[model samples]
Target: MQYVRLGKTGLNVSPVAFGGIPIQRGTAEDTKAIVDKMEELGMNYIDTARGYTVSEEYLGAALQGRRERFILATKSMVRDCSGMKKEVDVSLEKLRTDYIDLYQIHNIKTADFEQVFGEEGAYKALLEARHEGKIGHIGITAHSIDDLKTILSEHADQIETIMFPFNLVEIQGEAALKEAKAKDIGTIAMKPLAGGNLEDWRLALRFVALSGTCDISIPGMGDVEEVEKNASVCCDLSPLTEEERTEIERLRKELGNQFCRRCGYCAPCTVGIDIPTNFVFANYLRKYGLADWAKDRYASLKVNASDCIQCGVCEERCPYDLPIMDMLKKVEEDFAR
Candidate 1:
């Protein structure tokens, strides 16, 4: 497998890097074994989030002795300076590292632009961290194409990298992603396997590995086998076979409209429900068969899918035209069963 430059960041990363979301369902020892495999296979990019419960801590334990072997990336949702400053410190401690390769403003929305780039905003905190050598680069992750456009057009110089959903079903951000690449902003595909919705793991990994839009695609790997499976795609950087192309088209038609991209655009859901998150937990329950874990997470939410009051406001805001109320009702029914 060959290393690809992460845009102009001077870092060469594996085409199929490690996504840290699924490690929440595993143990620290599991993460250690997975990381060990990754190091052996030269899959050296690790991305995690401060919101992913124990993910950072597990990776911290796993990378304790060999922190220099990989590029460690993590994100936070805090938008204010003092809070983001504290969040960065917390991530560093939890990852057991003094310096992170990339620290991102996680899941940023267009509505957050002014505050995130303004005085006393989280960007200032990141700049401070970079100046202090606590982090190597600053990046932003958005789920919306409009937000991606705004970043490239307005603030491309401020961030070194960008992460958004770019998969067979969610290429809505393609134009913006291309523009980001043109500007030399490192592009990261956050949910390469369509958030666990797509079943053909090998083809899904190959699509993103060969796709020129993103410098790297991060598919979540729960254990060592998953890590190996994803890493194997890097070696087979061959063109998509005709059968794979047909299957990709079939999947796009089947899943293009209904799936939630987890962009969080349908905010202020009248009833305080996180619409995208409800769908996410429902996917974990139904598709991934992570029933107990998904149910536990769903139960923890103050607002569940059942809380939807049938208001169609969210659907109005959704870019993908997802029947959010109907989907929420289904999610409610799924959990009830």
Candidate 2:
């Protein structure tokens, strides 16, 4: 596997890190098998979060004797020093490690920065942890361009790494990511596959790696085959050919700007709508040419898009500022036909 220096952190890491979100869908044994494959290929970097249910615990169990082989990274949503300090201890305990290579402020926004970087904010706690040898570096993850812009411009000296969504279609973060890279802050492409919207995983990953903006891309992997596929791409880093470049344009035009990234920030829908799932099925029906399967899946949902009461609650939480009510209305209309 190919390795790159993770910005100022000075940690040599795999170009394609192992994203730990998908493991929650599997069993402990399944996680072990997945981690076993990652170890076999020397993937060497694992990114998980406190919010990803059971991901930290399962990864901790799987890392067992091999914890030192990989650079472990995780994030939390708390914004205060006390809360973040407690979270660091919890993450260490859950990850079954004495030291974490990277600890991040998860999904930070422009409005939360004042409090987060305050005298008694999460940043203080992370600095304290790094000083005490509990964490090696500090990073931030965000879905907003404004937030990334702020970090790269004014707060670049404060953060060692910055993660944001980057894919063939979602190149909105391109300029900011480039700026971050220029500043020597590790730039990680979070939704490298456009939240599973892109079918050509090889092209999707290659686009980000060759883009010159991002240092690494973390595509969520649940199985050994996925690890093998993503690792193979990293090992054989090549420029996109003319045909692939043309295909990239086609995908960008086809997906447009309104599609969901499946970040799941728009949760606890007032009416219990599985918002991302609805969008996924809709995409399958419209884009994947799987109308019957998509219809079946939508039918199985207890509350589909058509059931949306248009309460506007989800739109408030969506970091991308997508018009959720209107998008769901379109999904409802498409599935009705």
Top candidate by TM-score: 2
The 10-residue segment with the lowest total lDDT in model 1? 256-265
- Model 1, 249-291: lDDT tens digits are 9988877557886645678799899887888898889867799
Task: List lDDT for all candidates, in order.
Answer: 0.90, 0.92
TM-score of each prediction = 0.85, 0.98
What lDDT tens digits, residue by residue, belong to model 2 across residues 75-130? 99999999999999999999999999999999998888988999999999999999
Rate residue 267 of model 2 by lDDT.
Answer: 98
Clashing pairs in 2: none
**Candidate with best lDDT:** 2
